[model samples]
Target chain A: MEWLLEANTAGHKFALMAIAILLFAVVMGGILFAVDRPKRVPTWVVVAGFLGPTLLLLVVGLVYPALSTIRGSFYDKTGDEFIGLDNYARIFTDDGFQRVLLNTALWVVLVPLVTTALGLVYAYLVDRTRFESLAKALVFLPMAISMVGAGVIWRFVYEFRPDQPGVNQIGLLNQLLVLVGIEPQQFLLTAPANTLYLIVVMIWIQAGFAMTVLSAAIKAIPDDVVEAARLDGVGGFQMFRYVTVPSIRPALVVVLTTIAIVTLKVFDVVRTMTGGNFGTSVVANEFYTQAFRQFNFGLGAALAVLLFVLVVPIIAYNVRQLRLSEEIR
Target chain B: MTTTTPVMAPVPGEADTRGRVHSRAERAQKRLTSRTASVAAIVIAVLWTVPTFGLLLTSFRPELDIRRSGWWSMFTDPQFTVDNYNQVLYGGGTDFATLFVNSLVITLPSVVIPITLALLAAYAFAWIPFKGRSVLFVAVFALQIVPLQVTLIPLLSLYVDSGLAGSFWTVWLSHSMFALPLAIFLLHNFMREIPPSLVEAARMDGAGHVKIFFQVLLPLLTPAIAAFGVFQFLWVWNDLLVSLTFASSPDTVPLTVRLADMVGSRGSDWYLLAAGAFVAMVVPLIVFVALQRFFVRGLLAGSVKG
Candidate 1:
């Protein structure tokens, strides 16, 4: 930033960036308009028009930050040195980074699985119930909550006061446990378990999404097939196992893998709940810590890239599932 | 498709021998699969609901009682008063009612402006054929992945330069940018399902784009509009980040950030925080319940075959 400012004799902090962007948008819009004229536009013009905005956004928003991050990761904590993959190497060997990865992996696996299974069960049970709306609303309430709001609410749920330690725990969970003759447990700020606790919030918010999508898919299942399965003596658990599960398989895959990809980028809950302490750090949280807290943009960038690398395959798989569903239709 | 009469009960051994041990075990099993589920659902519902319930209770209770003990302990040390609500409404200070009005002012236009713009953009992406449409659409969709934190600094810089940083419009524009991709994606998916044949038929009648959009399409889009309205309303209503960035001034500040300050800065005053949060939540809750019917797959009645 210092070099760019020094070298460019424009002497205008905002003008250069703003004018460049506005001019680019205007030119691209004009090109798109002109090139789209029916058969008069040269093929080259059409190609340029089609690719311009995408190319501009990719370069400015994505590639620039990405390249900067890569360069920064090679540098020291202040992003001054050219340490050459020291951060990358550290990610594998460093205990902290490894813990972050393991916690993220646990999240990437557990939250999606639990949410989808719970959601599917709820959807199936409430399929044609009289109180279906009310039941669904109860579960869906969490979805309506902002992550910040939910975090704040849950903080009160897990609130601890050491000074008044035995003065009847105020946290709802501990209060209940105590009522049942169990000792109050510190749920947050506990190693490994805090990660799971964070995952629970994600699951709560995301399960409604899974349920909605899967319910739509379940409703789309052919009535004839369900009737046939019924006639074949499919009953109770067997019905869900053999008939309903297979029928909503696409929706399940979409929900699970979509969640997996999202969990890979989980940031807000961990940020709000534990501030990435107590071994609750994931790659995303680590990235934020490095970039914002520690000012190690390079390491943060590497962590972000690692996050993207992990997510890309899951995203591809999800997109492929969507395409397959489209093809089936 | 076989028309076999599949038994609703378990096929012999699988009949939830656990839940079925009781009378009407089949119905009980149908009620809840595992004892864990029943217990879990009840526990979660109660636990999850308590904080909000506390907020509600505190809204109605006196400030003194709220600060005295835990809200649940209200059962033991019962002290009831409507002083919180009184202060919220008619207190000599900045009451929540004034903040609620400010919230409405902040929320409504923020919701309306972006949704309207996104709808037009979504239509063009979904249906209009100027050229470069799919590529343009994909570019917009990809914007969904760009985290707002990265953009905020640049956007704030831009806002400062443009003399819009402290204005309400700044927050609106921020929400628009944050919301545009997802809104476009959702609306595009919906508009695509409106059967091109119907659109083509309208086109054959020599209807221009505006006419076609208004006469033939807008009515059909009511449910989508309603759903999107609810979504946008909820988002803008609940938004703190944007309000914090653009509208931190006393006159311009929306309720969420105000509520945050009230909770965090005002000596952890549960009475004030709860009352303030309740003020913020009521509108969104109303919007959620009222237009919730549009949330169903009903509008796709003739659009798709299952």
Candidate 2:
């Protein structure tokens, strides 16, 4: 039991893991065995065997903690004293916090629009072309990489070295700048633009997701509708505008809203690339920093709640759109 | 195939040939549109690929070579070694080998437990005549929208109070709890699509709910299970926030948390960072590339249903 709580070595850790899995298996197996007697067992007993763990976990894990966090947001830093709305006030009034909000605003606005636009255009281009799957896979590969990996990858690309004799540029972007006879700049150190730079990593990772969904949506457009548009002389960009865009409007909305929600919660890239320095922090990263790093529990909880508040409308609108689309179906 | 076709011979009652000619014309138009689109697509592909390619190539380059030159310089002066990988994996200070194992240990249970729990719950929601089934199901589904951030503070406190703050148990339990809503919703959707007759038929044969679940449903649910399994596998493997918050001790911290810490502490040590990034990424990339079909299905289902 003590070793289960504290595994100090590799052997101990693996042993603990095995024990945990076996325990889960035994519990679940016992439940099934107890309930496998058909009419001998009551329906409520059967239901409890299946649903009890999940329901109990949800109530204890998600529901209670979420309520506690919301409550914690109103208290003082140590979370013992009730300091009504001070954390929220500081979040709204503090200049640094405002930058976080502004950066979050930028992320919520730009990442989705740019990523969706890139994805939609890319999906449209390779919709039926030769080498389409391979090309799309190339764009979609980034989605598979963790954001921390992406952050490291981009950090390498943005690595800075001062310009001097015999000290060549190490970062590709800087080298490109040097090749074109321009001084290399600190891409991650500069304000405002640095946030955009961090946002690029996100867009890079998410474009694949956007493209996959939108490409499927484009394929789902009825061939008859396309043929009708072609018969009506809609060609080239006009076909894209009037026929393609309108046809996949539902998917486009879904892609945009999904990416926006994901972007709102993005933490790793900023945390990895800059550690939320240079005014690059969004609400998610700020929440982590406040809670864990600075031990400002109340402010962190407030930021977390702020994130929850921000996500609701987007999700609500997404559900509404999905419902509308389903109703149409 | 196109070269063998006659271009302008519209013979009588040869609708097939006419269709071929029409398609050829469409292909011609498509070729025209594809020209510009191809260029844009190529540019995007290059932009998306080069950063990752640069880091991967650098991971093979010697540490000094990496520090001194861009990876693109490899074309003119190709210097490579496996030392960076060696150092990152087994080097005394930056050993990723332990973290890699930690990632595997944390991820497998995290993925398996939630899917199993969600599977049973989804089965109940789909088949069992339980009171408040719809209400409870919707409540679980709605829990998906409650950001994991909201649960972090008090959950951490809960773990601290439970004497499990810095163990693998904390990470695994947190991940499984967070994954349930979406897993149950996704699995329930999958279960509902299993014709009700299948379960009813099993019941008529004197099979219990558990028997129907195992003998009838589990086989059909494999693909759904695989979809969510791959998804959760990749997610838990790549996660940083949960592992960082719960697994405060070195013994329990997974690769993402360690990798993120490396990026913070050794920001300039591209030698270590490059190899470490790959160490963290390789498992998910393999899972993703191998089970891409299931992964895409899961993604589409999540996006559409949500």
Candidate 3:
């Protein structure tokens, strides 16, 4: 058991993985077998067989921990003493945390709107182009890689070196500046601007997702509606404005709110690129920093609750939009 | 086929007789061939790809050259080497090869477990005439909004108390737990799409719930399964927060954690970071390209439906 738990070698890790999968299979197989017997089993037994493990895991993992974290938010650093809203007050009052809140606001607002807009334009442009699939795939490729990988790629692009006579700029952005006879700037060091630079990486990663979803929605626009608009001398921008936009409004809402939810919880891009430094720390990254690095669990729990609170309104709006779209359909 | 020439011409009324013949085709062609839109698309595609392409090019360049000059300079100097990749994979202090294997081990089970559990649960929610099924399904669906951050600290303490802290088991279990709500929600949507008469016919054949699920629904649900499977695979493999929290040890830490550490500790080593980033990206890129259709389908189903 100890060996399994502390497995380092390839052989042991594979062995452990195999054991875990096998164990899951056996337990699930047993439950299903019991439910599939010759005698008729009650619907409750069948339902329990299907849902029992999931409910157990969810209750143990998500429900309990969520409630505990909410409780922890009201406690002190050690979580032994109750402090009662002091942590939340500090988040709203402290200058450093205020910057964190401002940065998060910038991220949630800018990332979704820019990503969705770029995706919409790109999707419309390439809707029925000769190389539509290939073009869309090129943009969407970033969605496959981890945000950390995307961060590394963009970090290299934004890499900075001293503006010296002997030194040549390696970062593509810096090199471009040098080519145009401009001084190479520190893309990730400068405050406020650095946050936008980091936000670009997210926009890059999420634009593909937005494009894919919006492209499908564009395709689903009824053919007759487009034809009728075209027959009315509606072409170019006007057709897109009058015909296409209204047709995919539901999809537009989904794309916007989905990206917003994801942007609100973004940690990897900020963590990897800036380590939440230079006023680039969003709520998600700050939560990890406080809990893990700073070991201020109470503050971290407050931030986590804050994130949950922030997400609820976006989710509520999303659900409302979804309900509206379903009714229309 | 006969209207292909008219479709190519920009002049609209010259081919009025042929226009009505393949107007849909002509309209599609005109919509796509707008000169401004084409240029815009080409520009956006290049902007989207060039950053990653630059890094990919750097990963194959010699270490000194990569640090001293831009990857675009390689066109003139034209030096290339695999030493960066070799060092990142097996060199001292940074053995990403091991982390690669750890990612695989962690990802497979994390994906498999949630998907298997979600499938059964979705089946029950869709088929089993249980009391309060709709209420329970809606509850699970709503659980998707619970940010994993809210649950991380308590869950971490729980793992420590259970003596499972810093193990792969903890990472796997945490990922599975975080994934369940979305997985069950998406899969339930897909399950409900299958016709009820299919299940009824199976039941009429004296097949029990398990048998019906396996013999009837399982086969029909393959596309849905693949869609969600691709999603879960990508999510688990690409995850950083859960793995960082649970698997802090050397043995259990996956590639993202290791790469993030390398970036922190060795911020200047472009060679290792470039090679390491690509190494982490390779599997997902392949999966994304190979199974892109299903992945897109899954994305549409999960988001647009809800």
The numbered model that scores best in DockQ is: 3
Best by lDDT: 3
State the C-alpha lDDT per candidate. Answer: 0.64, 0.88, 0.89
* Clashing residue pair totals per candidate (backbone < 3 A): 6, 0, 0
Q: Which sections of candidate 2 miss by over 4 Å? A: B1-32
Best-first order by TM-score = 3, 2, 1
TM-score of 3: 0.96
If both were scored by DockQ, which would come out higher, candidate 1 or candidate 3?
Answer: 3
Q: Model 3 chain A: which ten-residue window has the lowest total lDDT?
A: A226-235
TM-score between model 2 and native: 0.95
Please provide, for model 1 over A211-234, each residue's C-alpha lDDT reduced to its tens digit, 9 standing for 90 to 100.
766766777788789867755655
lDDT of 2 by residue, A110-213 (tens): 99999999999998887776667778778988888788899999998998899898887889889999999999989999997999889999999999999989
Judging by lDDT, tell me the better candidate of 1 and 2.
2
Would you estimate the TM-scores of all the predictions?
Answer: 0.74, 0.95, 0.96
iRMSD (1 decimal) for each model: 9.6, 5.3, 4.4
lDDT of 3: 0.89
